[model samples]
Target: MMQHCNKMLHHYIQQSHSNVTIKEIIPGKLQGRIASPTSKSYAQRALAAALLVPESAHPAGWSELRRMGLCNDTSAALDAIQRLGASVRYGDNRDTYYIEGGFLRQAPAELHIGESGLSARLFTPIAAQSPTPITITGHGSILRRPVAASMVAPLRRLGATVTDGANGCLPLTVSGPLRGGTVEVDGSLSSQFITGLLMASPLSEAETRLLVRQPRSLPYLAMTLEVLRTFGIEVTHAPDYTEFVIPGRQQYRPTVCSIEGDWSGASCLLVGGAIASELRGAGIIVENLNPRSLQADRAIITALERAGAILASSGHLWTVGRPATLRSFEFDATDCPDLFPALVALAAFCSGTTVLRGTNRLTHKESDRAATLATEFAKLGVEIDLSTPDTMAIRGISTSDGSLTVRDPRLDSHNDHRIAMATAVAALRADRPVTITHAEAVEKSYPHFWDDLDTLYTA
Candidate 1:
């Protein structure tokens, strides 16, 4: 099985048939709109929460999730939930996942999370609820990222003995019927661990008060809270997002829920549209995004506006037109670290220098995002200075003539979905066709990304 999974990753990497070579984005009107994929983050969170619901709450309504993207991450989340003893089925529409709630009878030998960092971290505490010792592991790039002291420390605090395979990474062994009580989790590393704790706390033998010191990605935590509330699990947190108090032994009411369009994935499309609009004098329309979503990447609109793109939203459809003159802007990405790559792509065509903060958060991703973005964009002649660890100053060049100053360069995606997508978007204004290797990495988040990019073109 391990060999087979490795073969699959190799197949995805060597899929040059899927490599996208962009010479230019034709100057034309974008015809049909791209309905964004379902939020993988939301789907995973919902599935985790659903696993904690009692068996009596059978036949919960989960809508539009099973069909939205089917990326490896979301698929891993589904598989993880199943291992935890939830019976999941697809509706006739083939989009909604109907999950029958229950707890595990016996722990699986190993929970394969499949390169999804969220699934590995978020499900660890969930799996710890079992009396049986379980080994949590994953495949691909996730193996290199740390499980962090934040995760292991708190599990230990909750009465679980946690052990990691050297240097605090994957293949972690956790044993617990976690008797939750007041625990302090250092949230500066990543908020997903806290989210895991929150989702698993309600099932603990005692009330859980989670005190977080300096939480990052606050919006993602807010997103977790919103999903918890939808399933009738309440978590009370402070205004600054420092503390969360969860009442123990609370039941997760079986929910009838549909996932909203993903702002994270949609932000890539939205930025692509903004850059494409510059070439074609067209107002690109993107569907299925809520203007009021709590997602941090939803701030892409604000970034566009700052860069002088004409932008507006009517319900779910958002329109962005290129500005006559693109200007450099400053953005603090502390809460929205995922947007760094897309923002880097957008800033490449903006004039002068664009400064993006929160570079500190990029190190622990699938790849070191800051270094990867800087390396890949430099191939396209964009100068990125990361002298200060916490900030990145991108010196943008004028591509107003719809031609990149740099010659055609072969770019590598470093096996990151966002890097591949961001580089593709940046190629829109390039003087020559850009060739990208490992382009199929988008399957981790957006499986049909190439299909969506193909649709944006009109003869």
Candidate 2:
């Protein structure tokens, strides 16, 4: 696996297939329309299916195993499926995945998460379900990434033994009976850890209860619930995620499922459209997003509107074009840390400055997102101050022209996909070429990100 890591990491960059980096972005106010890629948030649902469902009849696997969208991030999820003893073969005419399920046996010797935090964090509790020991590892910026400490204590209580990197971090090893029971978790951190446990428990012998304390991003939990139901697993949650009941021995039904397009990645396009809408006479149009989606990143619409972008929706199609004038709007990113980069890009167009709170949670992301945002923006003539560990204040550049060279040539990915894409977007606004050293990190979610963005809007 380590060899695969070394090969994959070097393969993309050295071979110039890390995908294309934007040489320069002349922001003349983009006057075109574009559609975002399939949702990774939805794609992982298929992975969970492949893990728990079997392809046979007479109570074979999860019933909803059908054709689904294949995106870069979801491909990582499918890879995790392959490692867990499941057979994944795609249809020649269709990207359908035929998963032979029931892989609750011993885990692989070592589980490598690549550069995907979603795959890393979500797969942790799933790995704990096994009686045999599993070693979880990743490459790129993963070693420095912070997974919520909330994941540790519960698996311990469940009788699933675990260990972390130097400090509640990765390269974790866990051996478990995974005895299910009530445990406390902090919602203030990423909701993924708790979501992992919720999804893992039905396969356990004992029923489980999860009590969330800080619960910052609750919407993601809701999405997890939706997936659980879709996969034929049953979990009941009280109003606020205060309590969750995951029944044991629930049979997973096999059926096909479709993944949604990502609202998170679409944010960049929306911001670009909003910034240029006034000059172009129309904004951006996005499809397949649930107006009531559990993804906190869906809140981009609110942020765009607050910043004075005119937003109107027809059916599931959402449009964010030109705004009369973009203004600074303060955002509290306590719940959706993933939105920080797109929000920062959006805030740059505002007058005055924008301050985002809850930046303390960024250390675990692809880059130390707060620091990364500050550093990248500074190179473009935007200044950011980290007053609190979790808060950032950015002064906007009313006007920026010409190339803005990134100060540090060898920038770290922090193994977070959003950071990689965020830096690329930042480059699109500059005059000179914005070359990202390890740009392949974008594959953790949006594989065609640069391809799509470059089509209508050139950098």
- Highest lDDT model number: 1
Candidate 2 error regions (>4 Å): 1-29, 54-59, 62-72, 92-94, 277-280, 400-416, 426-433
Candidate 1's residue-wise lDDT over 1-459, tens digit each?
A: 111121111112343465533222322323457788888988899888777778776454332244445788999988888887887878888777877777684468689999888888898998888788889999878888886445888898888878767677888988788898888988887889988898998988898999999999998999999989988887898999999999888888777677778888877788877776534466577888888888888988889989987787899888877666678999999999999999998888788999999999999898999999999999888999999869999998855564466554778888889998888777766665566777768889988776677677543
Each prediction's number of clashing residue pairs: 1, 41
Task: Quote the lDDT for 82 in model 1.
Answer: 85
* TM-score (all chains, Cα) for each model: 0.92, 0.86
True lDDT of residue 364, candidate 1 = 86
**Per-residue error (Å), model 1, residue 235:** 1.6
- For residues 253-292, write the lDDT of model 2, one tens digit per residue: 6667766667898887777776644443765576766677
Report residue 448 deviation for candidate 2 (angstroms): 0.7
How high is the CA lDDT of each candidate model?
0.79, 0.69
